[model samples]
Target: MKTDSRWITTPITADLLRGALDLERTEHGVLPHRLPARARAQCGDPQLAMVESQPSGVRLVFRTRATAVELDTLPTKRLYVGAPARPDGVYDLLVDGTLAGQGSVSGGTVQVVDMSTGSMELRPGPVGTLRFTGLPGRDKTVEIWLPHNETTELAELRTDAPLTVAPDPGRKVWLHHGSSISHGSDAASPTAIWPALAAALAGVELVNLGLGGSALLDPFTARAVRDTPADLISLKLGINVVNADLMRLRAFGPAVHGFLDTVREGHPTTPLLVVSPILCPMHEDTPGPTAMDLSALGAGRITFVATGDPAERASGKLTLNVVRDELSRIVAQRAAEDPHLHYLDGRALYGEADAAELPLPDGLHPDAATHRRIGERFAELAFADDGAFAGSGGERRAGGR
Candidate 1:
């Protein structure tokens, strides 16, 4: 039996973990991975902070095939823990309720923070270890919850508890990558991130690798996606690469081809959706800005500017439109030969229609409501039952960088 097989066994009981907090019943003494907030509330655990916003112990939890697990397999599954409500610059992680992984952050760091319990501390943000564990037998579903943000998890149940469920197994898996916008920008809750929301609406499993500022088409990233196990996949490209003005046309074109080529190498016929960036008026046609400018918002500090006229948007000179055009053209050409390959224009996902009414809060990244709308549109277009993508696993599972 492979370590990370998608044959998940859930309806897991709280007795699986011996932690401080007692888990409330998920369908009574069991919790599945797709525990929605409402379900969590009903189960009494809430599953809220357990995802991202919650502290170290429960930020996120996953079932592992590790008996005495050695970390990593295939594409690598890493946990990204962010700074918590109280920044200690250090935090500890307990796997199966024992101190395991650890990293630390500096005090008062603005963008990201860290947490510490015992000697272990977790990484602040954007990056962290890609981990794997082995929990053998029909038992699946590990528990996660931070001590401070601690809510009850199924693991807190009594030992020798009854197996809540065996397996039904119909859910598909989703693979996605993008920028900070996709990572979860202004969303109020961690679970409310567009991808999370989309996953809920679609009823599929998800593996999200949306690095905030790091979706630069690195070969490593492409390789990561290619080798991982997924029923369906999508890449929300262009925006961040353009906003950062990170690469030029000469390199961008080849990068897109190479990125797809790498993935096709592994999952050649798997449903692959390559989506271009959504609209951003400022840098749509303009080369994005090089130096940070803050006068627009009238703020003192100058951060990266995402919008401006085509010529003046950036000194380094890459625009959102240029990247999106290049990306779409590449995907379209590929689709001609590969029936499984598909292209979704970002605008089709979220376009001028939306911009007219729901302007982006900061001229970049959508607010929560916009995220919902984008999710809805994506679900409508990509998973329209009769669409080419009906088999593509499109249940509002797309957002931008």
Candidate 2:
């Protein structure tokens, strides 16, 4: 539906956005970026460029009395050449911190990628709008969470009534970094992602840096984490290293230590937690460079298989089990000097037993239900009375420079 001219139009400003590090003005409108321009410029990888702009944990937040709201966006939806059609990305609206409504815009830009060969083609489409109606017409907080996997360019925001920047609720800020799993892979919606859900449950503000296929302990990423402000920090490592086959055992340990050292430069006393990879049977004992299961692909399903031999471990190839053991030792050795530093086995969030009941649909990322389970488990483990993030008593700090 065309937006009513009488509806109030508001400028999409930085103050109204959360979880994004930078905002780039585009020909259409503003694009929220998880990585800063400097960090982005330093790397030439298209994967990082794409995922950082997906706005995994980013959202528009404010105080409004509008009963109806509309957001105009140009979303770049990804399509695999031979894979089944994927659903449109979801937009979740919250009123006073509770899920009130959901919407999705159709007819945006489409990016077709070939999995077998690393090639991409972009097809531009018209801008679409997401509309949410019947919100409570009283002074209340409103949050419109962008899609976790879609690259969205904000064009306009329309509301039946005026809105203002919402006041901070004095919650502690939690900054977390991880892989695609933490980035909301296969999760139902943006807010339903584990980090977002855990943050809501723990009553803390969140700045998620869960870049898909690009959390490989890069100096720029470590610098990004070093620069971002937060009361608590957590790093979920190992799976990406194992699956990407990015490095050997000798390089993995030093890379992790260096990454932590960079983060500590800015937040020396902040509660920092290091988490290992969860149970992934494919990569647990077997090494990888995981490959797409071509047999399943022909049947319109996407699945992955580890290609590296288990014997490669003797030659320094990294596996999930090897990564986990190394991470445990590294954290334990570092904790004696850094009291705020802590370690949690990632299996505690999603373990062997949980996998048997709810196996990974793609042999990798969890399904929607498992995302919820992980989020709930994370909240229980990280925010409990004696949890790693416990006793963080202070007003939430503002994130983003």
Candidate whose TM-score is highest = 2
Worst 10 residues of 2 by lDDT: 392-401
Q: What lDDT tens digits, residue by residue, belong to model 1 across residues 223-295?
A: 7677666777889887767656677787889988999999899888878888887887766776754333435
Local distance difference test scores for all models: 0.52, 0.92
lDDT of the structure predicted as candidate 1: 0.52
Mark the regions of model 2 whose C-alpha exceeds 4 Å error after superposition: 1-3
Q: Can you write out model 2's per-residue Cα lDDT over 1-401, one digit (the tens) per residue?
A: 35567799899999999899999999999999999999999999999999999999999999999999989999999998789989999999999889998889899999998887878999999999898989888999999999999999999999999999988766788999999999999999999999999999998888999998888998899998999988899999989888889999999999999999999999888999999988888999999898888788888899999999999999999999899999999999999999999999999999999999999999999999999999999999999999999996665567532
> Candidate 2's error at 345, in angstroms?
0.4
Model 1: per-residue Cα lDDT at residue 232: 78
Top candidate (lDDT): 2
